[model samples]
Target: MSHTVTDDRQQQTHTPVALIGLAWTLVGVPLAYGLYNTVKAASALFSG
Candidate 1:
């Protein structure tokens, strides 16, 4: 019987900068819009 062993020491995974930026845009744009709308609505209540 023979046993074999394999080692993987230098494996690396990375997300490209463009992909990261796109991901942020996907998540942040709606969040920012919602925040803006909430603030706008809240201001109208206080200002009137």
Candidate 2:
């Protein structure tokens, strides 16, 4: 019988699903609305 093993670093090369989801959200929803929420939330969080 033969056995195979994989390395951990190779697993990180795949694209993340969250980023794809975010892209879909940006396109499916209104441009202004999506940008507005992202900008608003980010600014609020980082307004030092």
Q: In candidate 2, how many Å is residue 33 off? A: 0.5
Over the stretch 1-48, how does candidate 2's per-residue lDDT look in tens digits? 999886766544777999999998878779878889999999999998
Candidate 1 lDDT by residue in tens digits, 1-48: 999987868878998999999999999999999999999999999996
Considering every candidate listed, which one attains the maximal TM-score?
Answer: 1
Each model's TM-score, in the order given?
0.73, 0.36
* Residue 44 error, candidate 2, Å: 0.8
Quote the lDDT for 21 in model 2.
96
Checking candidate 1 for backbone clashes, the offending pairs are: none
**Sliding window of 10 residues with minimal summed lDDT for model 2:** 6-15
How does residue 43 of candidate 1 score in lDDT? 98
Query: Please, what is the whole-model Cα lDDT of each candidate in the order they appear?
Result: 0.96, 0.87
- Provide backbone clash counts, one per model: 0, 0
